[model samples]
Target: MKIVAVFNYLLSFLIAYWNTESVAEDEFIYGQFPSYFRWGIGTSSYQVEGAWNLDGKGENIWDNFTHSTPSPIKDGSTGDFACDSYHKYEEDSKLVKSIGVDFYRFSISWSRILPLGTKEKVNQAGIDYYNNLINSLIHHEITPVISIHHWDLPMPLQNKGGWTNEEMIEHFGDFARILYANFGDRVKQWFTFNEAWVICVMGYGDGIFAPGVKEITETPYTCIHTILKAHAQAYRIYDLEFRDEQQGQVGITIDSGWLEPSDPNKLEDIEASERALQFKFGMFASPIVFGKYPDIVRKSVDERSKQEGRSTSRLPSFDKYWTDYIKGSYDFIGLNHYSSYLVTSASSDPGPGWYGDQNAVTFQDPSWPETGSTWLRPVPWGFRKVLNWIKNTFNNPPLIVTENGYSDLPDVGLNDYGRIEYYKGYINNLLKAVIIDGCNVRGYSAWSLMDNFEWASGYTERFGLHWVNFTDPSRERIPKESVKYLRKVFLSNGFPKPTLPWNSIQLNEQCAAVALDPDTSF
Candidate 1:
């Protein structure tokens, strides 16, 4: 019943927003996908490059965590040799070009760029590897969308108390500047950090990921402050320093799933859902987009801190410069969305519950389909709802989806029908937003270009449109059935036939043709 209502609400919202005639033509009709539009697929350094301690690369939190604590990962496996894209990137770039994307979005490993987490000494190899990747992408006519940080923090920085320490803001900004000076000319789209919620909350709040620290009340809040501060500082540096020369745009990507209160009319449940909103979405969005923490966040955390007898809200404060620094930081908004959750306030008091989800909120929906990656559930309507929420909340800044894809269990085959289904549904919802809702959403990047490390879940969950053979030294990439379909969507500028059960389209031949000559996607 709850799921039905949420779907009904989303469908009606689409109906109000949609106008099929305007976007009914080919996908390319949107003006070379807007001069700002980017069709990209991404891979993070730690997740794909897999050269933890080689050629002067410094240690990072992931390096230490994966090596120091094995069992914390699902299969007790590390990313020591995952994908090995560092050595075989030429081949990988060839694959990316084959897919006919306009851009390649990959993160620079912080430890690789600044081994000591400082500019005192630059790692030549680290710079060279990325330079090669960037040059290769450009050589093949693919633009580069670079992320300055993506979960991999230099171990030295972590040892110095990481995000908990105030100094991190300036240090991270300096690092961003260095990249700005070096590659900003070629890489027009720069992302300061991937998603802070996963970094601070999941990693700090729950200790499930790297830099693993389980300090919910204190740590997560403090970490949020540092991440935002760092992002703001980075954005300011890039905006001031490189914007004129490189003429690029910068923004931080945030993760937010749609929330449906078990009962929207019920105040407590609604408030609980909103709190979850302020927690999951607001955790990062409030600071970046709104320039301050949400009211619910500050109040709730303040009261909690008072109960704990803390000096003040664990959430840090910035001086006037920072207040100004953090405001208007984004050139555009980058969002990674998947699934939706049903939020019902937990039992009132005096009961045990899920760690992060204590009397907090419960996420369940009988209608949503689960993924091999247990953290995800298929909820297509949620994508449109969340995108709309972002537009309304941020007054509709230009939006781009940095990451979105389905994950499957290891046993899933190369020809994944479920993956195809997931893409069609979410993308159809996305088209609904662009056509009906008139969202300024300009670009989309598949979650991953290749199968790489999946953090704590290890290699158990696969989200790549192209499968990576872990045992193969070459890490051979095989295009999944979904990849072809996605290319067609990209080629079409997301125009769709007015229909339901939209996952039965075919595109294997197109995939083969596109892969044959990646440089000329058209």
Candidate 2:
């Protein structure tokens, strides 16, 4: 037995060394992406369009959240004058065109179109503003990908319980009809909602985002249920009413971190890692793909509710009609992935919240490359793994990476090498997933064209390829090193062949070593 164990150890060491050496000496050469593969950059309305309450636009949850007396924003700043994109959209479109991208992804603020969050009144000026933006992108030969709702719920709707109330399904459906009727002619790609997990869990459960409400036990689940139905409603409307004429595709964008087991050899840790993904990604994806929540999620939430002495589960049950309505309601899946986490089985019950229900604990690895955002670490391998997970889970549905970027502190000047390296590693892995692993990924969009309001964190974190001088009244835009890198990748459609092999292999080695180390606790 001892001789066999020695042989296994030596063999594993040799394999690891061989892999590391091959990666170190390999040249960064990858085949061109598919001819139809798209590259783009994105920004949200509230983040870029700063005309808060201007030109008939109504107050949104974000406006209320940031303008509160005791501001929830880390920098005590609001999006009142974000990037002034509402007025300077032409210039923004020019910036996007200069990047040599195929498309530009932006969101529509519900409050901007419907001042009261209903069809009873429509803001013509708001409609004209978006019309000009869309026209500008088209004039520059850039396709427009629009997200209908990006967490900027109209305040009037929040007063009526926002996403937690079932009425939101109809309200959102009505809103979608207005959008399709007005803008569907030009916008070919539509996302019904951006990051449903963040909208429901962070906004309602953790109370850290807009419309902050901390009813941890039930509010999050209720909000998620309503959002899913609302998404389905919008998709059905587009499919039934506008598909033939508009020729548009509608979907939802979900943001989730890849969860890696702390100890691959431990069954509990492995199970906990998968449970975390099912709770996070599967919670939203499964309903649209498989017509129901993951069995583990259903069972765990039901069991927890019972243990908490509740007669019913906090998770709302979908009826047969609604289940069928939501099933296969999408033309594609938009994923907004940024980082990853290491998950382990919790030692004790975490109480009656979402985290407690999963019976799992997640944390970041200190050895991983860090970024300006504490929650985000550049883990490129995680991106590949998550892509594979989605392909396997959903039977390889058409996938688009709606948002992926690296954040930096405000002081990281124009020569930002870190951001360049970050993109290089992530995009290289992205190519590997598509070319080598055969994941059905069709497109990718960088997070922001320029830094704007970053929600609760405000302007403290910058995730833009172009630097926006927030202090200047004009908000001067200057391209960074990362911009040139992305432009090259966009122009070539993939990494170009190098004249010499690259030797800096720390990031790849760290990811591989950590993944293979069974005893290394995350």
Candidate 3:
């Protein structure tokens, strides 16, 4: 018995060594990534799927929000006819194949599948539409990564208070069951929600996004609680009912801008950075992973609620039953990181919003490169910092970078050296996180396959490998110079050794034709 135990221990050590040999030998000095690492791009249904009311499609909150308020969306435009991907998805699939990616991540519109957000009747047309899209992806040898919900709730559900209501738990579960029943055989990776923070805070607290409400304290908490429960329910349903047969993984995508202390030497600044993360990504992530809100978050929110004369904490509390249900609910954690912000302790509260709750002031360094959106500034090193944060906080859960890309200003032609540089910096750091720091990072996906509706910013901010011509009725998709660079990186499975400068690779003729003057900045 003693000799057998020694042999088994030796075998275990050898297996561990062999598993990490690639990382151990390379030391992440070069960007040579694990050959199995994936490179893909994504698009949300509402953002890219036009034909809003076509083919028995029901309305979503975005459809109502945009059409109801004439100027709610930026540029006074709506996603009603945004990219027309509903009709042009074959072209989109061809574009995905052109990029030579392993997978394509996309969301299904809730209303498209269940017009009234219920299982009373499933729309065959909606099922047919997604079947066509999924089939095309499989045919091209591109795996389909599907997000169950990406903030486009059916308008009928919005009428019943949407994510703020507990009924959404079962409603969303039914939606998940339908998806699993239909697509689970081919779809191995399932994301329950794209960014629960954005869905809860932006939609309810700020009133800047869909189903805009602006209730701030109570509504944001309530909405997020509902979303968390819904997510857990869907995960449990999949784990119990479908996971065995489908052999798939289910998780949720949580997004946040990396927060750094403005003055790292000061405890107040450091605490502010921690609080910023707690309020943003940790709000949704903690419940699903750790089974409750962070201790700091619970204490802060309860104290504030008491001071505000509330009978209960403003942040919702999960019962023991729900807590256990949500704990260990995810197979992986999806991170959609874009930029980093310097956070400082706030002297004055901003008032009545998610930012107000954190009591922190955030600003971008002027030295950072600005993108189309004022809020976005590339800080490549922050990628590894945030990844390490997740590693330590979640005890090194498998992570997929579900979204990361640089956005260029509209009308900027395809000489996207800036975006190429952005990708190189972030992806290089991601490789370091995986190889050097030992973060169980599995995959990386660019923000989008092509430019489409960019939420409230509309089409003004372009974050696509392919430049989409929104003005053209046909919505021509043009591959940017960055696409070529990205393809080479995907083919190499990492940054090529002896990295080339952004401008080192000559642009193809199609990209060169649209290049700005030699003196112009990218």
The number of the candidate with the highest lDDT is: 2
Worst 10 residues of 2 by lDDT: 513-522
Q: What digit string (tens of lDDT, one per residue) describes model 3 on residues 1-522? A: 546534543443344334434443222234567877888889999999999999888999999888764677888888998889999889889998988789999999999989999999799999999999999999988999999999999999999999998999999999999999999989999999999888888898888998988788789889989999999999999999998899999999999787888986676776787778878888988888899997667877887878778888888899999999999999999999999999998999666446677889999899998888898898987777788777766678998999998889646788887887788778877887887778898899998898889888887788988888898999988988888777777766874444224454543332332221222222
TM-score rank, highest first?
2, 3, 1
Q: For candidate 2, list the clashing residue pairs, or say none.
A: none
Q: Write the per-residue lDDT of candidate 1 for residues 1-522, one digit (tens) a residue.
A: 556544544443344334433443223221123345557788888888887788999999888888874368888878888889889888888888877788888999888889999989898888888889999888888888988889998999999999889799889988999888888778888888888888887787788887889877568777878888889888888777778878888888888888766885665565566667667776677666767777666666666556667777566666787777787788887888877888877675422112233345667676678778766888877787677766765677888899998897557868676877787667767766776666799888888887789999788888898898888787888988777777766665553332333343435344333323223243
Q: Is candidate 1 or candidate 2 better by lDDT?
A: 2
Who is ahead in TM-score, 1 or 2? Answer: 2
Candidate 1 — what's its lDDT?
Answer: 0.76
Give each model's clash number: 5, 0, 0
Model 3 score (lDDT)? 0.84
Predicted candidate 3: what Cα RMSD to the true structure? 8.1
lDDT of 3 at 455: 87
Q: In model 2, where do residues sit more than 4 Å from their true spots?
A: 1-29, 498-522
Q: How many backbone collisions does model 1 have? A: 5
TM-score of each prediction: 0.87, 0.91, 0.90
